[model samples]
Target: MSLMCDARDIEVNVTWPGGPGTNQRLEKVPSRFAFAFENEDVKGMEEDCWGFGVPPGARSYGWFKLLLDKARKTEYDVEDVAGELTNGLLELPTDMTAKEVVTAYLTKIYNHCMEMLEQRYTANILITTPIDFWLTVPATWQAGAVDDTKAAAGSAGFGTRDGDTLNVITEPEASGIAILTEQAERNPELIKAGDNAMICDLGGGTQDMQILTIKAVKPQVQLEEAVPGQAGKCGSTFIDQQFYQWMEETFGEAFTNLPKTKIGHGSKFMKDWEGVKAAFTGAAPNKQYYVPLPALGQALGATGDHGVASTAYDFMDNAVVLSGEDVERFFEPVVEKAFDLVDQQVSSLRRRKQGSTKLQIICLCGGLGESIYVWKRFNDFCKDRFKGAVKLFTDKQAWSAVVRGAAIRGLNGNTVLSRKAKRAYGIGVHRPFREGIDQEEDSYHCPVGGKRAVGAVAWFIVV
Candidate 1:
């Protein structure tokens, strides 16, 4: 920070509370309080309290499912909370809004950075210094949602630095920017100018895609969007939904209906499933795996051992036996959606066939994108479409790619240019309608120009 006193190029490493992937965790440094929250547990998260020494009236908490149970008991609007997490904001209480949670998290980070940087410089330098923040959001998020995130970040004290500005970039584009910059650092020739690539960022909450065309090499890694980015709620969590359904089928309605907190044993099932999903290569006809179920005690309660309980489910040996064939079904929906999105993005560019729209590279990143199954599916798609010409890249740091990329972009490096607009743009105008030239009924006087113009669209832009 001292060297890059102009926050534009400043770099600081930090961690998010209970992130979706392992890369989000900052190890090596004492975490002040090691904590994480994931899966459905995030639905009930109300707040986070972390800092140095005994902060006034602090409540130390861990990733516990009981938050959901508590949320249901109170007037905590869960539907609104879930909406806030996925979308942008909801008309909920200040403490319960996702915006508040995110800002608070960022505030903690800001405070930590100040504490660390202030040690080397006096308050005069620290107070006068300018620091800019760049936040990354999912490509699927609407403009309003991006604005909401920017507003939240500003509230978190990040807006106080420098020009009181906060920049927002799509997660996929940011990762692409980081990769492009790194490629240049290694060897400029590795990624030649005009090279076209697609960034597939499949994270826990959303799947974001961005197609870019390299514009320059010598000056810096500049990029232009060959096609508009596309994204949706197609992430690993979708697979979890399928597994939850399997639980309902394998166990019983009682298990499915039970509150998240009461189902402590389900955690074991989730962990085991993650292992199975990770190691699974392909469909093996006879291969089978056992995912243990919660014990059902003899007392016959929801929390009891399986067979003996009336409400709890019973397994042959306290496990749900799943075959490789059955496991494939659970992932098909999510994997298929990802395939479709990629195909759609690539197809759009191919149809246009303008300005080196060739997608030579397909880079996958994020927690779900790292899956062997996901890689194979995309690789197969690319092989058939490009006839083995497209290269697939998924490095080890993919989980942290977005953050790293956003950091690089914060340094004020231009990595994208001429992004294809997500939506079509056209202007409404007035023109005289002639006989047989336009439909008689389609003619109408222009409100502003007062001229009879056909109610026809010009379709000025192809995309």
Candidate 2:
């Protein structure tokens, strides 16, 4: 097998062109490395790296296409979408919002990153030499690319409800890439850590569980995608699904019956999908949600009848109460399977133990890692089963931790240096009418250009 290696594994901080609230940044330090040569496979490894709701992976792209039904909506003018909500992450996009357009455009790149991450280590084996590979590019770059590729792509208007919202901005994703690349260059020693550790990147959209087992000569993060591990398979989207179904059942046609309710809103399932998706990643298969029905009804407005035309608050009281039992019923098997996978890995590790090498830290980064239920259950299982020998890193920064690590990694790529440490960055954009459009954009920027680097590259990824 030919080995594809770059002397410097660049780091980067990815972000949006305009800036925060509408873009994303690495919330944590990241890791990057060159793909090495295995028997017949080209392999390199990274840990704790993740591309959430809109990951840059083929599966993600495929998933987006399946959800959008793009073939049926030829009139969709993507450039017309725009937004201006603060805590933009909290704001849902209307069809007019830029979220949908940006997401569709970004999905292609997200899939590209996923492909790169998957193949960087494994693809080279199929080839014969250390060839240069292109990681995914961010949206601003895509802006030009889309204009050249899409038939409807054109000068678009921007607004929140109607007009321009975010001020001048740079692609946050690109900014993240630049920072991460620089960080990686500054601190190559951190890459050496890959030899011993594995990454657990649990996020709002998906639980990206990767295993980086260090071999003496070869050190890289291996995706345990094929093999299940102790990590839960579900994600925040799971909870959202439950909430949606429950609302649909209780409210009946009322859920979407209001005059203001647009049929297209239902298509934006990805918003609440995060709830269910996050639930699946927890140590326990079960999760609970106490959504105030009235609040939902209010959001739905005239769409819901409230059974008796009663006050919205009254309707809220009648709403269903989700429980662990309900969650377990749907997620138990998946959770158990996750544990089983982890057990297998542990067993494998035990067999490989030669003498007395100490185990490394298993860091958990991502929104799901912050799940109280998940952490409690996972903690209980680890202590009881592993006898507390295994260490799981659960910090408050857990949700945005991977981006933090990615940023530090990006910083390492640059010439600036102080001491060794870890940290993160980014903004979130929400699309109301599209599938899987709630994307996080990197917000870090190069002071010089006031824009993010062209593509989002990073030195190290924790998940």
User: Which 10-residue span in candidate 2 carries the lowest summed lDDT?
Assistant: 77-86
TM-score (C-alpha, index-matched) for candidate 1? 0.67
Candidate 1 Cα errors over 4 Å, as ranges: 1-128, 162-164, 184-190, 257-259, 262-272, 275-279, 285-293, 296-319, 423-463
For model 1, state the Cα shift of residue 35 in Å: 16
What does candidate 2's lDDT look like per residue over 206-245, in tens digits?
3444333333222222211111223332434344444445
lDDT of each: 0.60, 0.35
Q: What is the C-alpha RMSD of each candidate to the true structure, in Å?
A: 9.3, 22.1
Model 2 residue 231 lDDT? 30
Candidate 1 at 19: error in angstroms?
8.8
How much does candidate 2 score in TM-score? 0.39
Off by over 4 Å in 2: 1-104, 107-196, 213-233, 246-289, 295-320, 323-334, 347-360, 413-463
Give the least accurate 10-residue stretch of model 1, judged by summed lDDT: 76-85
